[model samples]
Each structure stands twice: as structure tokens, then as C-alpha cells.
Target: MLSKEEIQRYQRHFPLPDFGVEAQEKLKKSKVLIVGCGGLGNPVSSYLAASGVSCIGLIDSDVVSISNLQRQILYKEQEIGISKVRLTAQKLKELNHHVEIEEYNLNLNSKNALSIIDKFDLVIDCTDNFPTRYLINDACILQNKPFIYGSIYQYEGQVAVFNVNKSANYRDLYPTPPNPESVPDCEIGGVLGTLPGIIGSIQANEAIKVICGIGQPLIEKLFIFDSQSMETRVIKIKNTNARDTITGLIDYEEFCHPNKNKMVKEITVKELHEMIENKEDFQLIDVREPHEVEIATLDGELIPLGDIPQNEDKIAKNKKVVVHCRSGARSGQAIQYLQGKLGLENLYNLKGGILAWADEIDPSMEKY
Candidate 1:
């Protein structure tokens, strides 16, 4: 049922014996929902849209910052501070007028995960954080949809297929979310600009194959590619009984961990600015890694998370200690460790960490 223009446009696809008009038609009929339109989301959506996916749903609660241009291909410097999903949708539709682009410019939370995911036949997990990735996996499992998972860290990237027809899932592979502090991010762990492009393209390829039921999908297997070494490895994942306990969608926050995040007193960026303006005497403790400090940093002592115990004595005990990281999470963990574990009660977690400082107090700073 393709238009004359569509037929001629995809004539190259028609010549492939296995993927003729039937596969093209299947692709046109497929609805693929891509969550997290960041690094991986860029190429995943671009290729799928170019492949002529019928309906492409984009979910992201992020804005296009100047730093995202290095890897987020869908955005440009001109589009900075704009909504990611909205801009991605416009660009994707412009790429191919026949492709329907649905933009959900909201954060995917426990409340909205099921409803949003169920609308699409497949979901792609391009999220950077662990919480959303787990949420996507669980939602796809509950909704009985296939999911393409891709992640980038430094010079390496990983792609996996999970929750397809009750195949092995993320839980079977990891079974638990790592402690947030233990994991490194692109800000702390830098990625090559081309790294996500490689991984995301692979994810898009897998997504289309799964949609058209053409080539063998990467079901229950993890594909690991290291751009630095130019090596690729595939590991088989076994299905687990984790689904037995998952009858319905429970709170994803509590599912990842408990309702209890590390307990810490926090001070907002405005409040911190006030303290600075008022010339208050407080010691700022930046608990981010050395590399992260190099990117965008606050004026503070650079005692990393791992070095806290050894350098506890170096932490200024005379002044009120304000602990911070890229965001507040690491600082929260640091505060909890200092107070709950190490018995230092005078620490406060900066509300949004250095990123907040960049957005509100200081616009000169750069971060991912």
C-alpha cells in the first residue's frame, strides 16, 4: 500500500530477496517507542525513521544542551535549551514525511511507564541511568513487548535484547541495579563522540529486524563492542524466574532499591549563592572523581567518593561542610557515609550539585 514516491524511495530494499515489499510493509506498519532521546536515541530514531517506521514514539524529559551536540545527532547548536523529544520529532518527520512521530516530552516514571510503553510494539532503552533502564525493562516485560537495550560508558558500549516473548531480560543479566555511586557516567567516564553512534546504529538495526521478523534478533544475548579496541563480543543470557514475582507494575523507585535514598540535609543552589554572597564561612567538599572535576567543578576540596574514608581527617571539621557531586546523588551518598557510617554530622548535600551551579549560579561551567 505504499505511495508511488514511497515505492521508488525504498526500491533498494525491494531487491533484497528476504526483505522485499513484505518486509517494507511490515516496517511501515511497526510502531517503535524509543525512550531517552539522548546519545543512543539519536541514531536509533534516525535509522528507524529512515527505515520508514510507521509510528515512532519519542520519550525524553531532557533539553538539548550545548554539550549534547557531540553525540546527540538529532540536535544542533541552534536547538539548545529546546525540548529534546519535540525537536527530535520535527527533525525525524522532516527526514521522512511518511513516518509518524509522536513526542512525549515527559519523564518516564512508574505512573506513566505502562501506559506509554503499551502503545508501541517495541521499546528501545537508550537511557543513561539505571533506574529508567530497569523501569523500561519491567514495563516491556509486563506489556509483552520486545525491547532493544543500548548503553555507552567511556570508550565502550553495550547492546542487548530483553523481554521479548518472555526471553531473558535485564534482570536475568544483572538481577540488580548497581549502587548509583559505584557506577560512572559519561561526565565522569568520557565517551568517544562516535561511540554512541556505533552502538545506537546496531540497536536500530536490531529493532528493524525484530519488527519485520526478518533476520535473527539479538534475543537473550548481550553484544559488547569496544570502540577503543575495535573488538566485539556476544554473551548469551539465560531466562530467569524473576518474572514470576512481577505480576504487575509496582513502584520502580522502590523496585530498584528501597524508598530510602541516602539521607542527607540539602542546600539549594540559591541558598548556596546566598551563603556565598553573605560571605558565609563554610567548606565546600566536591566528592566527584578527578576526571569529573576537570569538566565542570566547584571551588572545593577534590576528595573523591573512594577517598573519603582515607581522607576523612582532611575534610574540614572546623567549618560547616557542604558536600556535592555532578548532581546531588553522590553527595547524598557521601553525606550518608560521613554521617551514618563515619559519624560526621556537619555535612550537607548541595541541592543539585555542580550542574545546578552551572544552570543557576554559573553559566560558564560545562557538563554532560
Candidate 2:
């Protein structure tokens, strides 16, 4: 029962063969849960809201930063430090008042993944990390809810529909997560501002098709788009039967990364600050980008996450090495690589990276 305003707002879609009031009513009755409110999530939620999806759940554990303004089109510089989920919900409401926005300012981990995912009819995997992707895939399969998956690298991106019609899923595409150090994220190697826009729009298109069951969805197929070459390819996704082995939600972090249980030392910002005060003999490594160093930096050598392999000699062999980034994710990855691959042991990750330093040690320093 869409209102008069809703009818006029979605008038453009009424021209489809069978997508008039009947499809609009189906859209109004559907519920979707978008796992991430960044890059792809921005467009996916925007279109879904305009199409008047009854309930759109937005979940993210990140805050808006000036750096995110590049690809995440929904945020502004003024909104920095605010919760992304909250910001996205507010903006979606403005675009379509009739659509309901449910915001969760929390990360999706093994503990809450299944229970939360069970509530929605459909799920959209807009997450960036591997652990979370695997968690979403396993949970969706267990709950018998279909999910649309989208992931973007610098210029190339992949999109697919999973668990719908018992089709191939993420596990078929990637049987196991690669080493964290081997894979570089957008933060380490920047993404073109327009890349996510292209991939995200496609993700939204597939989402609508799935919701209405009007068009052929991306079931058992993966769509690959390259912006630089403007090449598009669709590959058949053959199931590895990995879904059969999944009995329940296991530790995703441990599942995605086997080294999670490894003992990796971490030093707190306060401790590092104390070391600074004492003039302790230690080597500080900044695993962030050069531009990130310009934004905010500590007394450390700049060696980006991707360039870690070639710059192995830069790490001091005699002194303790402390790695840091925007958050501890990349830095921890650096420590893992240093120990596992390079066989270096004198390393420690900054507990929470510069964000921790900004909040605890130096409030004047910017936190991005």
C-alpha cells in the first residue's frame, strides 16, 4: 500500500512490462540488510531507498573521514568523525521519507552475524575486508537468505549474487582467504574515485532485479569490470560444494586468517609515548600512504603496506620495530607478514594505531 507520493516518486518504473503498482507493492514489502555503509553501500542503499524498499538496514563500525570523501559519495568533509551508518541513514531518509532506515553502529562479527542476518529477507555484502565477507556468506547460507556481493580493488571490481536458487557463492570463488599481507586494500593502494561509483551502480541494478524476480540475476555468475580498459567479463561460477561443509558459524577471523591465533605483541599508544619520553631505542614504521603521513604522522619511517616486501631491509635488525597505520588493521598485517613470511621476530604492532595516539596521548593530533 504505497502512498500517492510514493506512486509519483516511482512513476518511472511503472512503464516496465510487469513492474507497475504490483512490483512497487512488492518492493514496499521487501526488507534488505546492507552490511557496509561505505563506497558500494552508498549507491546500493540510495537506489534501494528511492525504489522504496520497506526496511533498509545499514550496519557499519567505521567513522567518516576526509579520505573517504573520495569514493564514498554520501558523506561530506563536515561529517568527519561521525558514524557512517548514522550518516547514511539520515541521508537515505531525506531521499525517500516513506522508506525506513535501520542503522546499527556496530561491526558484524561471528557472535552477532547469524542472529542479525536471520531477520532480513535479503542481504547485500558491501564490506571491504575478507573476514567479514566470509562471515556474511556463511551466515546467509545458514539462514537461507540470498545476498548480493560486491567488492572493489583499485580499478577492477567483482559482483555476484550468492545463496539464491542454491547457486554458487563466495566460497566457490575464493576457497580460502589469502594472506593479509598479500592483499592490499583501498587505504594502502588508493581507488579511483569513480571506480566504486561504476561497480556500486551495477550492484544496485542486480539487487533490484533479484528483488522483483523480473530479470535474470547474477546467479552462478560473477561480473568483472575494469574501468581503465573498459572491459567487462562474466564468468560462470562453479560451486566447490564448500557450502556443504559449513555446519555453523565458526571464528571468522580465525577462519579467514589462520595466523589469528599466533602470538603477536602490541604496544599501546601511551606506552609508545612513554618510550618517546624516555628516548627508547626502537624503530617506528608507518605502514600508511604518503598522503596519510601528510595528514597526520608520528616520528616514524614511511613504508606503505604494499611496499613492505621490497623495503624489508629498511626495518632495523638490531632495534625493536613498531608498525602503525590509520587503524591497527594494516599495521597488524605488517607484523604478521614480518613474522610469518620474512621470519622477523623483533616486531610489535601499535595497539590501535594513530587513532589511539590521537585520543589518548595527543588529543591535538588529527584522527582519520
Candidate 3:
């Protein structure tokens, strides 16, 4: 069914012993939706495009920042200020003009998630946050689509294929998300630059295998990688009643934290702007390290949550205190420190942290 030019274009892959013309043709007919366009999405998108996935959809509302240059291989310095979905599509187009690259320049919230997932043949969860990951998992299960899951911590990463028909889902492996504040993000905990690159490529591999109907998929098996040790671990998972109960993308944000009222205080990036403009007399504290300050400046004192007690004098008792880190998790810890020790009456958290602030307020600020 391929034209002369189509045959010539995929000539190299077509001649392979196991993956011949059939595999290449399968790739040309498959459509994939990659969520988050970030660390994991960058590598997944790049490899899938290069391998000639016919229709690719990139969903992200983020812009390329200087700090992302470390591992987001799809972007360059010139594309710094551009939206992630736009720039990613542009680059992927250049890589393979034969592939149809689509862009959804919006965050994957509850409102648009179902409509988006229904359009693609498969879904890739490259999102960094727990809320979005659970959302993607639930949505894929409801839609009966295959979902490739990837997650990374300091130097470790996990990958799996979830929500496929007759296969295990994300909830089957880990039924409940950890306490939001209990886990640290890549910004707070830090990740090796090449970590996502390795894991995401594996996710893309699973996608390709699914399309070609070759090789055993990683379904019901969670692959763990420790880059430092150059070791990989595969943990087997089984289907459960809990996964069956997941009908659709429920309030994942609330599901992750059932007692939202009793949990940490939350605020939006817009709220932070309002407080700043109104000249709120709160002790704005930045918990990020001093080196990170060289790239971004916040209108707050730098106490570096790790060294908070050493600089306790900077936090006044009577004044309101607002703490923020890269993405608000550490800021919650800082809040706990201040409240437990200083016992401040008025304390607030800049919910999504400085990264969210940059995304919402100033696109020019570099995100770490």
C-alpha cells in the first residue's frame, strides 16, 4: 500500500530482518498522544517522530526555558521563549516531514482530557506531577486505550504500559498516590539530565512494539532504572478490582489528597500576582538554593528551606509569611518548619511554586 517515495523514505527500517516493511507500515498508520512535553515527553516525542509515527499529538501549555535545555533535547537556545507544544511540533516536523505533527497548547486538566485522549490511538504519560499521571491513567482505562507510564525521581525512573485491554492499569500497581507533600519533584529533589531520556525512549519502544505487534510488551511489569548503578529492575503487577472501578478522570487532584480541607493550603499563580501587586506585607520566602537565584529572582527573602532555622530571624512573628520553592512542595515543608517552631498565625503557600509563577506571570524567567 506504500507509494514509491514512501518505500524509499523508510528503506533502512524496511530491510531489517524482524522489523521489515510491515513494521514500518504499521508505524505510518499509528497515532500517539504524548502528555506534558517535558523531560520524559521530549525524548519520547523525538524518537517517535524519527521512527515515523504517522500522527503525533503533543499536549502542553508550557514554554521552553533555559533550564530545560539540560535534558529536553528537542529544543535549543533560540527556541527559549516559545511555547513547548509549538516549538516541539516545529522541530519534529523538520525531523520527519512525512509525519503529521499536531499541537495542543493547553494544560491537560479535567475539562479537556477526555476529548483529547479519545483522538489518539495510544497515550503517553510524560507528565511530572502525580495529579496529571492519575488523570491520564483513569482516562485511558475509561477509554480502553493503551497508556505508557513513566516517572522519575532523583536518579531513578519507572516505566510501564497501563490500561490496555486485558492488561493491568496504573492503579493495579500502586492503588494510591503518596501524600503530595511527602514526595519531592525533580526541581526539589533533582534528577540526572539523562534519566528521562533513557526512560522515555523505552516508553516509545513499547509504543512501537504495540503498533508492529512484535516483541513482548512491558504490560503488567514495572521497569525500574538506577542510572548510577547501571541496573534495571522489573517488578510484576497484577490486575485488581480497584483498576476496574476507575471509570474516568475523576478529581485526581482531590483523589490524591482526600482531606483537601485538612491538607496543605493551596493558591494559584494568579493569586500570587494579585498578592504581589497589592503590596501584601507577608514575609515572602524562597526555598530554592542560592545558585538557582542567579537564573531567576523572586520578590522574597532567600532562606533556602534546608537552612531555615539558621535564618529564623528573617521570619517575623506578627507578619504574614508566604513560602515558595520550585513547585510548592518544599515550600510546604518550609511552612511546617515555620509553623512548628515560630507558630506564625498567618502563613500561606504559593501553590505551584516559582515554576508555576514563571508559567503564569513571566514567561521569560528561567525554570529550574
Best by lDDT: 2
Rank the candidate models, highest TM-score first: 2, 1, 3
Write candidate 1's Cα lDDT for 221-275 as tens digits. 9999989889999999988767666676666666665623455678899998898
- Model 2: per-residue Cα lDDT at residue 102: 81
For 1-368, candidate 2 gives per-residue lDDT tens digits of 87888888999999989678888888899899999999999999998998889999999998998778989999998899999999999999999888888888999988988888877889998989998999899998888889899989989999999988677878999888897767878876668899888878888888888888878889999999998899999999998777897788888788777765475788899899899999999999999888888889996999998789899888888889899998888898878877877788789899889988998988899876
Our model 1 lands, by Cα RMSD against the true structure, at: 2.5
Model 3: clashing residue pairs? none
The Cα local distance difference test for each model comes to 0.85, 0.87, 0.84
TM-score between model 1 and native: 0.91
Cα misplacement distance, residue 286 of candidate 1 (Å) = 3.0
Per-residue lDDT, model 1, residue 288, is 86
User: What's the number of clashes in each of the models?
Assistant: 0, 0, 0
How well does model 2 score by local distance difference test? 0.87
Worst-scoring 10-residue span by lDDT in model 3? 257-266
Q: Candidate 1: global Cα-lDDT?
A: 0.85
Off by over 4 Å in 2: 261-263, 306-311, 340-342
